[model samples]
Target: MGIIRKTFYTTVLTGASVFGYLGSTTTLISPLPQDDPFWRSRSFARYNVHHNACTQDICVKRIPLDKIRPELLQKEGDLVLEFCRGVWGGLGYKPQRAYLARKYQGPATASQLWTSEQLSKSTYERGTQITDHFEVVEKTPTDIVVRCGDTPRNPNPRDSDGLFVISAEVDKQRNEAVLALKSCFFNSGRKVEGIQGPTPGWMEEAHRWYTRLWMATGAWRVTR
Candidate 1:
């Protein structure tokens, strides 16, 4: 009986120690820039630079806006606003809240901030130091193009030197729209810090996945 009690206590202590270690060292994903408020409070063990490249990932997903006409797609109202809201709100690991700045430099230029809570409870609450800039760089009756600028506060010190465009292509006869998100970026200069992620190949793949996910979410929001 004494031996059994000692073994049980030892096992319990071991389990407790393991759990405590995991709780202390586990790496949680902090909210990305442009996420919602639930993600505002989270911690990141390290910055993951999946793809710090000049290569491009073009994720094109087309949705038929049967109800809306080609002419209406160019205007800022229900369809346009909904699509913008979709881009602002959708696609995050956690629930997100997005805010767009009221002041615009030009007709379609604006800055947006996304804040979200960490999926897991975290003490850190800087809400991913990143800001997104967007612009309606090109607009026509048939096509409207939205450009997303490099997010600030990037963990990877490489810096983004590329173009990211999300364009809406309208088919007048079919009355359908094609949504395309192109992420083109190249890392410029050397790493300021000695730190970097392990796998460069995986980083590019992850980048593609993220951009694709973002495109898919936006497409689903507007079309569905």
Candidate 2:
């Protein structure tokens, strides 16, 4: 009877957890659309070569600009920047930063290392290195692309030096803006016989969940 009661409670908790995750505003797209500009880009093609095992996904949220408060609409660029800033400000990105800080004995807060103006400038510039090993590789008015881990900039990336591409785009159509956070990871040395070229299933699942949480929180921050 005790075992039965425990099993019942576990099932209920699991179901509730799943329900809560599904209730978030974020949605995920896997194997990103083939014809999309991002997928067709030379940079993407380079990272997705035969020697690399790549995994790609996108988390998306839509916001109706008309519904936003007047005070938040002071400047269009500010809103875009706020959304970008909010992405890094969320729980998903914080733990890694905190961990790195503890490991390196460095300042944990962005304020300690960079002023607001400097951070913003670096965030938008190509070739600029940001926190968490992310480097800005591409930028446009509505989009920014960052490469993390072993980037293409390295002439010879190690087999263990996997690479990740993280991008944020705000696509405006009519009165709504679609916010997308696209992520792609490349496991180096796919051709090696015994190489672990693909991301593990469990890690991929965890990444998707965290990304959803991040997108939802970022959207809430920008919209609020």
Candidate 3:
């Protein structure tokens, strides 16, 4: 009887955990199937987007401009660069150190390479590698788009075809600016091969939550 009771509770808890996990991930929308011309052409055509887990697929987030005005939106370029420099390392996931490995002056091209190091958050672990092929695929006065992809040194296979598209613009009609981040990656075996296993569904939920926090914090940091 005791064993039966334990099994019942375990089953109940497992079901609850699964339900909670699914509820959290329901809103995560990958950009792969979207009709946006630029995303379709540039990201899809160029990368190995498999639409898997957090690191292996695209997830997007947006935040309102709030007090940020249109005039400030014109500085999107500087804001993005600053976010990469000052904000990315400390994003809510885990705190780490980062530094630029490349430089760019004007609009970047397909060959424009941007590399940076994300030092391990743990005092004992070695730093993780990060790189981006940056290009201003499109830019206008009030809006700009920057595309980023991972490079060879990145440790995770999921990052091999990684892409992050940052788009910023002011919407005068809505009285809010939009800061949208679209991210995707491909492949998945390397990081999980050794002792690690497949990414748990709960971690994806955490990724979605932390991603939103990261975007919100970035928006606040830039406009603050």
Candidate 4:
């Protein structure tokens, strides 16, 4: 009787395990279903994007994300708003939400005020355009200057708010975070660390890639 009971328990356990495995596999291994609306819709379909999108990539040549935006991580080539999140309250962005949505989602249209600034984020990202490229210049060991976008000249530049060199410095660095900024005047009393690793999976992968980017090219932009 005891042997039979043990055998029955083992059989039940195995069956449960098999079912559990299959259930988990559906979410992880199963392809986007053919029946799913997106797969067949044709208008739009996308695979999972990295959840934690970074505008700042960390690299050997660059500073860490938390160092720049203590509370958030940014990507390598995102627009000004996302990248500036490393700044205090990120100072938000010069443009409104609708503007950012347009920029981030598809073809970006700049405000009339944005004309004086670099036209494309790529220009700033690759250090291609001399107007907004600052990573190459080192204003000081601590204070780095932005390139020639809008330097204290224009009351309101085309693409940005100010027309001068926005400055920043390494207020502090720790395992919790690496803190720095594009403008020191704004960061009078800010937290040096708050960024934390995202959850596992795409979220984590996104952060890792972001880290890779900044680790490579993040630097202080100085004036010539």
Which model scores highest in lDDT?
A: 2
Pick out the ten consecutive residues of candidate 3 with the lowest summed lDDT: 119-128
In angstroms, the error of model 2 at 118 is 7.5
Clash totals, every prediction: 19, 0, 0, 39
Which stretches of candidate 3 lie above 4 Å from their native place?
1-33, 49-66, 69-71, 82-86, 89-151, 154-160, 188-200
lDDT of 2 at 44: 59
Better of 2 and 4 by TM-score: 2
lDDT tens digits, residue span 34-79, model 3: 4654445544454434333334233333335665533555654544
What does candidate 4's lDDT look like per residue over 5-101, in tens digits? 9999999999778556433322221122346332222111111121212122111222344445433333322323233222211112323333534
How do the predictions measure up, each by TM-score? 0.44, 0.70, 0.48, 0.20
Candidate 4: what lDDT?
0.28
User: Which ranking of candidates, highest lDDT first?
Assistant: 2, 3, 1, 4
What TM-score does prediction 1 earn? 0.44
lDDT accuracy of residue 48 in candidate 2: 48
Per-residue accuracy of model 1 over 1-224 as CA lDDT, tens digit each: 99999999999999778555433432222112345221221111112133332344455554567744445465643453344344545663222233333222233332233333221111111232222443343333322344333443232334444444445556568756666555444444343343332236677676655655555455545652
lDDT of 1 at 223: 58
What are the lDDT figures for the candidates, one per model?
A: 0.42, 0.59, 0.43, 0.28
RMSD of each: 15.4, 5.4, 11.5, 21.4
In the predicted model 3, the residue pairs found to clash are none
Best model number under TM-score? 2
Which ranges of candidate 2 are over 4 A from the true structure? 1-23, 46-51, 69-79, 105-123, 150-174, 188-197
